[model samples]
Target: MLYLCIVNQTASQNAEEFGFHAGDIVQQWLWDDDVDDSICTKIEDLTGEDLVDEDYGTAVDGVVIWWRDGDDEDTLADTIVDATTMLEDNGPVWVLAPKPGRPGAASSSTVQSAAKTAGMNAATPLTVSKDWNGIRLRAFGKGR
Candidate 1:
């Protein structure tokens, strides 16, 4: 199955000591511009990957889109940017799976609790990490 990993580049850069470099690709695209034409084109051109508009939503801002293709990880970057990027980016943030029954799926309550335990304040934006089931809270704020 395939999984989508969305991230906010700006936030990710600010929160982490290691910032995004030339290879990092986020899942979101500017909402105001021609989402299909402008953003998708940029993704295709920059990352050599195609964008599918079927997953479009108000929450999506940028993405480090990923999916499994025959046991191979398909996406644009090497370093896994920290979750802080989402807060700075203001993403409705989402993960799109190619099929159901993915191993990473987690309950909403679990995500909330995990975030809280990590000192993720309500004022901070949320960052979701994709696991085998679906979504998991990776980090909250500029976690050291």
Candidate 2:
């Protein structure tokens, strides 16, 4: 599945770095200084033409942004590519999942329950693959 990851460039440093964002789709390693509260407004203020249809929300470290454009593979791919490019070049990307009870933290149960919350019917317990950078995208299914 194609995913878009919007981030702050100044904090991420450079495009080649593939900076970490808390809610980023790619899931990369992260550090202590990557956390920030104002990530949403920053993403909203981004002056890019490609960011037109982006739906903005709040994630662990920064803003959660996604596109609502029609189901076009090329368009989705292009947007994801651009967003990642900007994430790396523009700022220090935060990819780490915040610990539970912390300011921007997400609980382990929440991560594990993604499938159930999404209405995926399964008989086994949800197992989340820890990427240590961001959330995991797991295949919805029943356990043995």
Question: Best candidate per lDDT, number?
Answer: 1
Tens digit per residue, CA lDDT, model 1, 1-144? 122223455333232211222333344321322122432344445544444342343232334332222322212112113222433343323322223344433334433444455444222223322221222223355333
lDDT of 2 by residue, 26-72 (tens): 31222135343233233333321111222322222221222221223
Candidates' lDDT values, in order?
0.32, 0.30
Flag regions of model 1 displaced more than 4 Å: 1-25, 28-60, 63-81, 86-89, 95-104, 118-144
List clash counts for every candidate, in order. 19, 17
Clashes of 1: 19
Q: Residue 20 in model 2: shift from native, Å?
A: 11
